[model samples]
Target: MPAGSFTMGDSSGDRNRADGETPRHQVALSAFEIDATTVTNDDFARFVEATGCITEAESFGFSAVFHLAIDAPPEDVMGPATGTPWWSGVKGADWRHPGGRFTDLEGRGDHPVVHVSWNDAQAYCEWAGRRLPTEAEWEYAARGGIDGAKYPWGDQEVDEGGWRANIFQGEFPRRNTGEDGFPTTAPVRTFAPNGYGLWQSVGNVWEWCEDRFHPATYRRGTTAEKRTTVTDPVGPADGQARVMRGGSYLCHDSYCNRYRNSARSQNTPDSSMGNAGFRTVSRRGAER
Candidate 1:
C-alpha cells in the first residue's frame, strides 16, 4: 500500500485541456493496494476456467472491432460492420476473439483482455474477491506520486529518455507508424510501473470504475469558491453510464488524450467494446 496526497487533474501542461479537468485541486488518500497490471488474457482465462464466467460481449454475439483490424480482411468478411467503415461491429469479437473471426488471444495471452463491460468486470472482481476501484481511488492510484502531474511518470511528455506508454505515435485514423512499439494494446506491464508499483494504469485500455457520469457533478460544491472534497468519492448515486479511466491504445492527441491520470470518460454499463477492459481492487482486510 502506498499513501500520499496529490492535486488531482492536469497540472498546467502542453497536453492539458480545459473542459473536463478544470480547476485542478488537491486530494489526499490513504494507502491502498491496486493491481500491478491490467488483467491479462491469461489472467481472465484462469478466472473463466475457475468460475465458468461468460462475458457480456460473448453473450451479445457481437462486439466493437477497430476499423483497421476490421478492414484487413479480404473484403468478404461477414458481419454487421459499422457504417463508419472504421469501427466494425463484428460477431464473435469478444475477449477471446478480438479483431473478429480471424483474430484470437492464442499468442497474446499476456495482452490485456478487451470487450469487457462494467457488469462483466464487476462479475470478475466479485469472483476474484475484489472490486472495481472508485473513480477517486482510480485517479489517486493513477496519479502515482507526483502531485498534479499530467502523465503518470511526471509532467515530462516522454518516458525517461524514451517514448513511454502505448499511444498513437503518428497520424490518427489513417496512418500509425507504431513508434511506440505497438499498434494495438501492448502486453501488460510492458512499461514501467508508477510510484505505487502499478503498471499500465495510464494506457493499454480504459478501466471501469465504480461511478456514474454527470457533467454537473464536478461543479457541486459547498460554496462557489470550492467544491466539496468527497471521502472515497463514489460520484452520483444513479446514472445511465459508468465512468471509465486510463484511456486506451486508441487514445491519440489528435482525437482522445484521456490516457492522462486525471482524465475521465464513460460508457453504458452494458456496453462492451474492444478498447475497454478493467482490473480488480480489494480492500485491505478482505480475504485474498
Candidate 2:
C-alpha cells in the first residue's frame, strides 16, 4: 500500500458508533506491504512445523468458541463465561480445533486461523520477517485509498447481495442463518479484495494491531493541533489489552455493527478466541 492519510476513528454522527471510536482525527502513514489476507491455518502450520512452536491456545489447553459452534453437553465442552455467555470456553479448542474437540481444520486450510492470541500473532510475524500493523496503519490500509469511507468498499450497503464481507446473519450466537454464505470463518479472499488488494479487511475475523487498547486514546486536539495530522501514531503506553480492529463473524447490524473501517475492539494479549485472527505488515523500505 502506498503512503496516504485518513480519519482514524468514527465521527460523532456515525451510526452504531462505540465510545472508544470517538475523536475522529486524521492519520498519515508511509508506504508498507501488508499480507493480502489474514494468516491462514496453512501459513501458521508451516511456521509451527518449522520451529515446533506451540500456540498460547495449545498451552492453555482451551480457547473461547462461539456457543453455536459447540454442540455437546456443557460438562463435556467447557462452560461459558458469566459475563458474555455467547463465548464458551470449549476444551480442546485451539487454533487447530477452532470449534471444539469435535472440530478440526481438515479442509479449511485457507481460512483465517482463529484461536490465536496477540502473542501468537507476534510470534508468527517474527517468523515471517514481518510485524503486526500499527493501529494507524491497519485503519489506513483498510480504508483502501478512500478517505472517510464507512467501509473498505466506500459506503456500500453491507447487505447488497451480501457481497461485501462475511458476517453473522439471521441471529447472533444462537443461530447464524448463513445468509452471507458463512456460519463460521469464511476462506480468506472469499470476497473480492479492497482497492489495495487486501482481503476481508473489514469483517470475517477481527485483526490484531500493535497497539495497547485505550478507550479514548486519540484525544480531541486543540484547534491548532486539529489542523495538523498525527504521523504513525502508536496507541497509549498504559493498557492491559491490545487493540483489535475490524469486527468478527458475529458482527451484525442488530448487535455489533463494527464492520466499518473505523471500527475497533480489543482483547487481552493472552486471550485467544474463535473470532480473532491477524495480518502482518512489512515496511516498504526494509530489505526483503
Candidate 3:
C-alpha cells in the first residue's frame, strides 16, 4: 500500500467506545505492502514442514475454541474459560486440528490458520522473510485509503449488502444460523479486497499486529501541546498483551462488534485461539 495520512480511531463512535476506539487522531504512515490475505493453513504448513517449528498451542497441548465449534471428545473439552463462557479450552487443539483432536485440515487448508499466537505469527514471519504490520500500518492498510470509514468497504453495515464478511449470524454463542455462509471460518479470500487489494481486513479472523497493546496508548497525546500529528505511531513500548486487529469470525453486532477498521483488541503473546490468525507485511517496499 502507498504511504498516506488518515485519521485513526472510531470516528463513528458507534462501537468499542471504551475499548480505545475513541480520540480519532491523524496518523501518517510510509509506503508498505501487506499480504492480501491472512496466512492460510497451507502457507503455515509449508513453514512448519521446512523448519519443524512447534507452535505454542501444540507445545501447551491445548488451545481455546468456541464452545459451539468444539469437535473434541467430552473429556478433551475442558468446559468454559472463566468469564468468557462461550470459549472453552480444548486439548489437542492446534492449527492442524482446528476444531480439536478429531478434526483435521480436510477442506480448510485455504482458511486462515488459527490457534496461532502472536509469537507464532512472528516465527512464521521470520521464516517467510516478512514481518507483522505495526498497529499504525495495520489501521492505515485496513482503511484501504478510505479515511474515517467504519469498515474496509465503506460505512454501510456489514450485513447491509448481503453478508459482506464472515461473522457470527443469528445468535451469539448459543447458535449461528450461518447466514454468512460460514459458521466458523471462511476461506482467506472469501470477501472482496479493499481499495488497496487487501482481503478480509475487517472480519474472518483477528490478525495480530506487531505492537504492545494498552487501552491508554491513544491517550498519550490527548493533552494539548503533545497532540500533534503522529507519524507512524507504534503503540505502547511495553505491555503484556500484543495488539490484535480485524475482528474474527465470532464477531457479532449484538456483542463483539469489533470488526471495524479502527477497532482494536489484545492478548498475551503466548495465547492462542481458534479465532485468531495473522498476515505479514513488507515494510521496505513490496519485495514479498
User: Judged by lDDT, which candidate is best?
Assistant: 3
Worst 10 residues of 1 by lDDT: 71-80
**In candidate 2, what are the lDDT values of residues 1-288, reduced to their tens digit?**
787777877742554444377677777778888999999999999999998989998998888888887744466566768888888888788888888877788999999999999999989988888988888889888888888788888787788866689888886667888888988899998888888889999778999999888776776331346767887677777889999988988898877888888888888999999989999999443222
lDDT of 3 at 48: 98
lDDT of candidate model 3 versus the reference = 0.89
Badly placed stretches (over 4 Å) of model 3 are 222-227, 283-288
Residue pairs in clash, model 3: none
Clash list (residue pairs), candidate 1: 67-86
Per-model TM-score on C-alpha atoms = 0.89, 0.93, 0.96
Error of 3 at 103 (Å): 0.5
Clashing residue pairs in all predictions, respectively, total: 1, 0, 0
> lDDT tens digits, residues 163-267, model 3?
788889888879899988999999988868899989899889999998888888888745564456888777777789999999988998899989999999999
Q: Tens digits of per-residue lDDT for model 1 on 178-230?
A: 88888888998787888878888987899998778765555541235554454
lDDT against true structure, model 1: 0.75
Candidate 3 has its poorest 10 consecutive residues by lDDT at 279-288
Best by TM-score: 3
